[model samples]
Target: MGQQAMDTFRSCIPLFQALSDTARQDIILLLAEHDRLTVNEITEFATLSRPAISHHLKILLENRLVEVEQKGLQRYYSLSLDPAVAQLKALIHTVETTCCKESF
Candidate 1:
């Protein structure tokens, strides 16, 4: 792979790690369905405890997969997938243009 491809993949590692967990995936889907939700609200639909949900939310937030909004004392979480999706798409394009070309 070229340096650009490698760098793109490296940058995406956190996103991949954030998405590797089933709990995080569930949380993402929940947010997608509901548009936005609080930790306690998400906890109601999930089998995990509030703290556990918050932990996953933290990871998701760190990776930029989700965004948070403050409403008084409550915080609402929602998907902020555009940046991550654009990165993944760039990775795909890099692989197609570089790796696949080299293979052929």
Candidate 2:
């Protein structure tokens, strides 16, 4: 990959940096299983303190990795199928296909 493409991919991974491993895993699992979540819900499910969840959410939001919607008094968060995710998936596909032609 070119430097710019690689840089973008590297930067995207840092959205999970503020999270503990378990917290990061929980977020991924939640996104896979649910359509959306509130901050309180994520904090409870992830077993992180509310402030920690909020910190991680900030990174996710700033990077456009997650979308936020305000409904009345609550803010809901959901995974965003943005260009970064698409590009990362495409890159993974290329690597897997080229490196493991028979299996992947």
Highest-TM-score candidate: 1
Native-to-model Cα distance after best TM-score fit, residue 19 in candidate 2, in Å: 8.9
TM-score of every candidate: 0.94, 0.65
Which portions of model 2 miss their true places by more than 4 Å?
1-22, 89-104
Cα lDDT tens digits, model 2, 1-104, are: 55655655565465445333566557757976889999998877876788988877786676666788999999999987575467567667655655454774
Q: lDDT by residue for model 1 over 1-69, one digit each (tens)? A: 778889988998999999999999999999999989999999999999999999999999998999999
lDDT of each: 0.93, 0.71
In the predicted model 1, the residue pairs found to clash are: none
Off by over 4 Å in 1: 102-104
